[model samples]
Target: MKDTAKHQGLRNQLVKLLAEKGIYDTNVLNAMNAVPRHLFLESGFQDFAYQDTAFPIGAGQTISQPYTVAFQSQLLQVKADDKVLEIGTGSGYQTAVLCKMGAKVFTIERQNELYRKTSVLLPKLGYRPRVVSFGDGYKGLPNDAPFDSIIVTAGAPFVPQPLLAQLKIGGRLVIPVGDEKQVMTLLIRTSETHFEQHEFGDFKFVPMLEDKNR
Candidate 1:
């Protein structure tokens, strides 16, 4: 679907709603406004794209709720040129937001269908991340270790150690940790072996698959 004036208007309203809900980060707000969320979903779901809710995007995964996306993006506090590692590419909506925030994003997706579709869709919309690999998100990207920040778009029963090991000192890792319900958790690597932890209430997300087969 083409991003028309009406779509932009809806996005603006969404941004306002996000701001009202305490997403104070202006960078995150602007990035959310810039990305055409409707284009990321199937045409039939375009009508619900701007709403702050999650909708299925096939393969049993749903594009995350807009507030969740904005909340995670705000938690990262990404700066221009910061190397950010994203744990689940999903529909590439979060990846696009990171790109818009001037981050050099390297993302991995466990679902092959989403991996292939997002790989093509993102660049076509001019939101090109550094790498969009079809692999396990739990393992993180060791070859590109020491990222400035990392964000996990799926819910995990526990925090993956490899992801923590891959962060640079002072880097942030935003993830939702739980089984049925998730508590939004953040880990900031302060030293080589130490990390500061914080939690921000609960959210629901598709379980993060372990292997690339999905």
Candidate 2:
């Protein structure tokens, strides 16, 4: 659970890899570096934490690859203090990065076990998202609608309507949509009734699940 000297060195190398692969947002890069990815993994896999691959975090979820996290984060265009609605809270690693970048995050996880584990673990690690709920991410947090940005950590077969409805005009939503392989998609709420969509190629992710529990 410690952010050891070795972990920081690995993260520094990871920052370089992310940079070579085009994740140029300084905030995103710094946040990626600052968070110790090893602490998010099982002890056995801790050494591989910064190697640019997803590692299982139980409950059928994995801590996302650092590049995917950084890539999506950069696309989010997060501003300090932006109210970010995160649709998945797997391992709380991504949430930690957002928090480090000064986003007030409201994150949801469908599985209660992962929810409880991360809810406890995050605060212990110093991440305090605005809210962390165990529920259907597709529905989002309507009471906290008008978010400045939203990021979905899993692959969705289709874009959920409620999530889109929750964004403030001019807000951004970053999601991956597809079945076998997802196309990283971004939506900008350009008007009260209109949105701008863009796709950024394919990536694999665990399918976004629904329901309050398994």
Candidate 3:
């Protein structure tokens, strides 16, 4: 929970690394630097938290690499106070990033263990989202639909229709789509019945499961 000067220095280096990788969003970078990522990991893995690579957290999940988190956050184009839906809340790292940027986030995690742990850890660190759920995310939080943007941290074989339907007109949905490997895809709602889609490069993610546990 303590963000020592040493931790801040490491985060500064991480920010430069992210900038070199072509992430130019100052808001996103500032938020990244502000959040002490080391606090989000277990003590044993804390030292590597600032690295540009993913590390396993329990329950078959991995906290996304800093680059990935920044990349996705930038692509989502989050405006302050935008209501965003995050499909996976592993480690609550990305959730913290969005919250630091002042987005009202609604996140869902299918792993009960992860959901339970993060549900508690986030607030303790002062990164509270609007809602966190222990349920399948494929259905897309209908009760809180029409999000300004939606970000899926886990890999999905295809875009879930429910997620598309949940987006407000002009909202964006950022997701990785495919199996084994995924193409980073972005969807922007253009009208009541249309969405613009684009794909950029590739990434690997734990599959976004259909059921609570499978």
TM agreement with the true structure for every prediction: 0.98, 0.98, 0.98
Winning candidate number (lDDT): 1
Q: Give lDDT for model 1.
A: 0.94
| lDDT for each residue of candidate 3 in 1-214, tens digit (9 for 90 to 100) | 6989999999999999999999999989999999999988989999888999899899999999899899999999999999999999999999999999889999999998889999999999988899998788889899998899999999999999999999999999999999999999999999999999999899989888897553
Candidate 3: segments with Cα more than 4 A from true spot: none
Better of 1 and 3 by lDDT: 1
Q: Residues 67-116, candidate 2: write the lDDT tens digits.
A: 99999999999999999999999899999999999999999999888999
Per-residue error at 141 for model 2, in Å? 0.2
- In candidate 2, stretches whose alpha carbon ends up further than 4 angstroms from where it belongs are none
In model 1, state the lDDT of residue 72: 95
Alpha carbon lDDT at 56, candidate 1: 89
lDDT of 2 at 177: 99
* Alpha-carbon local distance difference test for all models: 0.94, 0.93, 0.93
lDDT of 1 by residue, 1-214 (tens): 4899999999999999999999999999999999999999987899989999998898999999999999999999999999999998989999999999999999999999999999999999999899999899999999998899999999999999999999999999999999899999999998998999999999999998686466
